[model samples]
Target chain A: MTRFALTVEFDGRPFMGWQRQSHGPSVQQALEDAVHAVTGERTAVHAAGRTDAGVHGLAMRAHVDIAKAIAPFRLMEAINARVRPAPVAVLDCVEVAPDWHARFSCIRRSYEYRIVNRRAPLTHEAGLAWQVPQPLDEAGMADAAARLVGRHDFTTFRSAHCQADSPVRTLDLLSVERVRDRLFIRAAARSFLHHQVRSMVGCLALVGMGRWSPDDVEVALHARDRAQLGLNAPSDGLFFVRADYPDEG
Target chain B: MTRFALTVEFDGRPFMGWQRQSHGPSVQQALEDAVHAVTGERTAVHAAGRTDAGVHGLAMRAHVDIAKAIAPFRLMEAINARVRPAPVAVLDCVEVAPDWHARFSCIRRSYEYRIVNRRAPLTHEAGLAWQVPQPLDEAGMADAAARLVGRHDFTTFRSAHCQADSPVRTLDLLSVERVRDRLFIRAAARSFLHHQVRSMVGCLALVGMGRWSPDDVEVALHARDRAQLGLNAPSDGLFFVRADYPDEG
Candidate 1:
């Protein structure tokens, strides 16, 4: 058996999410079916992160083992071809160590949230970005984001369905920048709890809109209660950019 | 009577173009209907440029004259509200002089073409950009673009159905730049023949792909024959960025 690592990019608009579900289609089911069609074997695929519905992926890392010996180029091309008419694409594929784990071997993960601060309704960016009709103060949002960095109990920012054992996680970076009418919030960490990034961004957005003070972020983090959350931003604006592995160069 | 100059933005994937069509929907029709709904008066609206189908607008300039007495803010808000569910928006509205015109008063027009130079198929940017799988040489494309940035008889770069009265046009600027895996071609001029921007970008793409030399662009321009055209790019990647009027700050 040969193990291959795949970098994937998907629209995330049509499926239930990355994980396969009994009720609906998903990115995982799409890839597993395509692998079955090409290799005549049903194989399980694991990803570094299981994104939510309506969340986009610029490059999510995954791995699968196949019994049939095939060239990496041919395997990648065949899988991409078989997944036609779907918004998912396998960007890069390569042979990896048999023991390498896509879920466990990951070191870092990063995400970005996109917001269009404009009064006009979205057209091209309707589903791709969050449209906040009110103006947002980027400086104020940045100040508020500074309070969320470093190790802390992020219970207020995690989803009730999250399966992590503890709420304590290290946030390496969280920065906000404004370009004209657009606001981008970038967050990086060793790992994140489910819905953590979106939940933090939601409260920061209220601060940017002047509805909440910067101190409120610190207070909410101390409360560690889900009810203290200002809001949970929609899934449309979140994107999983990439995953980093150690042992390069 | 009041004449209001409005700035518009739209995603052009759904309509047949900007002008009213007999058999299909158009941006003009959308705006006209929205106006009639709000003011109960049918009015003709004129735009600075009538973009073709699948061509997006960032801030298209237009004007409409209404006999009803209405505030500029109310008029803009009502029209935007009534145009719901459509991918159109009114960015700004102001009362212009009685003789002000959207088309005749325009002094300069600028456009941008986006090309994603990558091997993977687009997902989030499916309709917003053009995907070119081959590697593109940015410097080569830039060198070729410089050749077409002056006064010339651009017969080879025009559409056969274009209704321009003269083939002679003075192009003020044309520059190509590569930002990572993307290429942006910007063009500005007092006016342009139909298909002019797309035709030039098509040839530049060939130069970047090494199929044609840089000097071939100059030769094609000198030939002044439409038969010498290398290609006419699709309407998916083109965008009408802005129009310059002398009276604006």
Candidate 2:
């Protein structure tokens, strides 16, 4: 048996997040089916992060184990060829150490949220980005975002469905910048609580719209109550940017 | 009657082209229908450029005459509301002089062609960009593109079915730049013949891939023969960026 690491990119509009589900299609089921078609094995596929529905993946890290004796390149090609019509592609594939895990061995993960600040309705970026009709004060949003960058109890920013045992996580980076009419919020950390990025982005947007202040964010963080949460941004603008492993640069 | 000029943006994948067609849906038809639904006037919509099938528009300039007296803001909102699920939007609108024509009064028009230089299949940018599997040397493509800048007889690049009275047109700018794995080709001119930008990009792609030299591009331009053209790129990546009028700035 050999373990192969795969770098996958997908459009999340059609899938029910990254995990397998009985009610709807998912990225994991599609990849697993493709692997079955290629190798005749029902090998399980594990990803570094399980994204929510309508969340895009730019370079998601994943790993799959197969007992079939096949080259990495051939397996990648065969799987890609079999995954027809699905909006998923394997960008890179390589053999990895048996002990390396896609989820546990990963050290860091990065995500980006896109917001198109405009009054007119979106055309090219309809589903790809979240459109905010009001003009945003990006500098204000940046100021408010800094208050949430350090270690704190993120209970107010987590979803009710979050299953993580701990409410505290170290946030390495949280930045907000505006380019023309588009606003980008980038976040990086070892891991994140469920809906943490979206919830943080929602409060930052309120700041951008002049509904909240920097101190409000810090106050909310200290409250540690989900009822005190400002808002939970939609899943349309969320993207899993990449996952960083210690072995690979 | 009041003449209103509109800055439009659309995803061109669903429509046959910008012009009205009997066989397939067109952007012009959608706009005209929306105007009729809003103002009860079956007016014609004229555009600065008639893009080919599968070509997108970023900020295409167009105009329509409405007999009803309505505020520009209200008219824009009404039209936007009426054009549902069409992948088209009016970014801006304003009243214009009766003599100001969308097609005739335009001083310059700009276009952008996107090429994703990679071997992996596209997911998010499926119909938004052209995927070139081979590696491209953008510097070489830029050098070849420079040869096409300036006034010249471009019969070699004009389409066989082009209706322009003459093959002579001044190309104001042609530039190629690579940002990461994406290549951007920008072109601007007062007007263009059919298939001119795509034809130029196709030949430049050959230069980037080492199949043709810069001299070959110049030789083809001088040949003044349609058969001498190297290739014509697909319409998927072409975008009508914007149209410039003298009085706007």
Candidate 3:
């Protein structure tokens, strides 16, 4: 079997998540089914980030093993052609080493969370961004975000159903930037404890609203308890931006 | 009566255009009906650009006169609240002079056309951008576009069904810029003939595709005939970006 690496982009509105579920459709099932239709092989496609429902992906990295002797471009074309009219598209595809796994081999993962700071209700950006009606102090949010940048036991951020064995992880970067009336939160790390990004963003929003001081964020991280979580931001604002691997730039 | 100016944004996928249509919904009709519901007055909303079907608006300037004793912010909030569930948002509103007509008093108009140069089918940006699978020579297109600037009788670019009395118009700016795999064509002028921007962009695309030479563009422009037009691009990628008036920057 030959392992093929693929870069995929998708709009996550109609998806149940990256993982297949009995209740609804998923990105993995969509691609796997497309692959089966094209090459007659029932294979599982693994992604670097298993995004939740209502979350988008710009360039989610993944890998699949196929026994068919197909060219990389031909496989990508077949998958893209069969995946529609689903909102999944294979952006790039290439052959990779057999040991290179999609999830386990990923070195860094990045996500971007968008917030539209405005009074008017969302029009074009309804499901694409989180809308905050009240004014947000972006500088304060940035200050609060700085406290969660380094290594820590992020127990307060992990979801209850997270299957990760360890709560300790090093966060490489967490930045809050104000672009006009929009606030963008960019997070990067080797790995995260499930809802870590959303949980941290939610607390920073509290700082933006003056509800929680910057000191409160550090205190919550030190507490390391899920009960201290202020809020879990909705999945609509989050996007799995990209995943970095060792062989790739 | 108070003349209020509004900065509107909308996703034009669901409407027949900005003007009121007897067969389908329009942005103007939605806002007018919302105004009637709020103020109990039959009003007409005039916009700077009356776009074609399936075209979007980022910050289209518009005006409406209402005889109600209401503040600008309250009127804006009421209209936004009532126009709910529609892909239209009143981004900003302020009182203007009675003579400040939306269309007649406009000094400059700007439009942007987006082209996604990619082989894969669109997923996240289906209706938002026009996807061309072929490679585009953006620099060549820019060189061809520079030939269209300044005063000219743009008869070859106008649509056959255009209602303009005169085809002579001054194009202040036309620039083609390539950002990664996306091509953005921005155009600004005091005004434009019907289907002028789309027609120019379609020919520019031909130049980018190597089908037409840069000199061919100049020859077509000098032809001064509609039959010489190569193509009229789809309205899906066109956006009425902004409208400038004398009183406001």
Candidate 4:
């Protein structure tokens, strides 16, 4: 058996998220079915991050074990062809060591949240971005983002369905930048709890709109209660940017 | 009575183009319907450029005449609210002079063509960009583009169905730039023949792929026959970027 690593990109508008679900279609099911069609093996596809519904993936990493003797390039092309009509693409594929894991062996993961700060209704970016009609003070949002870039018990920002053992995680980066009416918030960490990125972005948006202060973000972090959370941004704008492994170079 | 100039944006996936059609919906019809709903007036909306089906509009300039006594901001807001679910938006609106025209009074029109040079099938950009699987030499395309930047009879590039009286047009700018896997071809002119931009991009793409040399573009131009056209690209990648009007800024 050969373990192959795959880089995937998908539009999250139609699926129920990255994981397999009984109720709705998912990215995982699409990839697994494509693999089955190509090699006649029902191999399981494991991804570095299991993104939520309506959350896009630019270059999410994943892995699958196949016993068939197929080349990486040919397998990639077959999967891309079979995954058709669905808005998913296997961007890159390569053989990897069997011991390597897509989720556990990952070193870091990064996400980006896109906000179109405009009053007019969205045209081309309707489902691709979050539309905030009010004017945003990006500097204020940046200041608030700075307060959340460290190790903390982020119970207030996590989802109640989180399966992680601990609420403590170290955030490597949290930064906000605005170009014209578009705002982008970027976050990076070794791992994130359920809904952590969206929850943090929601409170920072309130700060950008003058509804919350930077100190208020810090206060919420210390509160450690889900009820104190300011907001939970919608899943439309969140994107799983990339995952980094140790031997990426 | 007042003449209002509107800066419009739209996704062209659903419409038959900018002009009102008998069979399918159009951006003009959407704006006109919204205006009638808000003011009970059957106003005609004239656009600076009549884009073909599947061609998007970023900041299309259009004008409408309304007899209702309404503020420009209120009209804009109401029209935006009523034009819901159509993927069209009035980005800006203001009162203009009686003689001002969206089409006749326009000084310059600019367009952008997006090409994604990759082997994988597109995910998020499925209908938004044209995908070229082969590698492209953008510099070669740029060299070919430079040869078409002057006044000449552009019969080879004009579509046979074009309604323009003359085939002669002076292209002000035609440049190619590549950023990673995305290649953008930007064209600006006082005016253009129907399908001229798409035809030029098609031939330039041929040049980029080494099928046609830079001198071949000059040969095709001098041929002065539509049969000399190498290709006519799909309408999916064409975008009506903006129109420049000569007036007090």
Per-residue accuracy of model 4 over B107-205 as CA lDDT, tens digit each: 899999999998998888887899999999999999999999999899999999999999999999999999999999999998999999999999999
DockQ of each: 0.74, 0.76, 0.82, 0.90
For all predicted structures, in order, the TM-scores are 0.97, 0.98, 0.98, 0.99
Q: Mind giving the per-residue lDDT tens digits that candidate 2 earns over A112-144?
A: 999999877887777789999888999999999
Q: What does candidate 3's lDDT look like per residue over A1-249, in tens digits?
A: 999999999999899989999999999999999999999999999999899898899899999999999999999999999999999999999999999999999999999999999998887778889888889999999998899999999999999999999999999999999989999999999998888988999999988988999999999999999999998888888999999988876
1 against 3, candidate with superior lDDT? 3
Chain A TM-score for predicted structure 4: 0.99
Docking class of 1: medium
> What does candidate 1's lDDT look like per residue over B62-98, in tens digits?
9999999999989998999988777989999999998
Q: What is the per-residue lDDT of model 2 for residues B86-188, given as tens digits with 9 covering 90 to 100?
A: 9899888899999999999999999999999987778888889988888998988999999999999999999999999999999999999899999999999
Question: Model 1, clash count?
Answer: 0
Against the true structure, candidate 1 reaches a TM-score of: 0.97
Instruction: Assess each prediction's global lDDT (C-alpha) against the native.
Output: 0.92, 0.93, 0.93, 0.95
Interface RMSD of 2: 1.2
Model 3 has an lDDT value of: 0.93
If you score just chain A, what TM-score does every candidate get? 0.98, 0.98, 0.98, 0.99
User: Residue A155: error of model 2 in Å?
Assistant: 0.9
lDDT (Cα, tens digit) per residue for candidate 4, span A165-211: 99999999999999988999999999999999999999999999999
Question: In candidate 2, which residue ranges exceed 4 Å CA deviation?
Answer: none
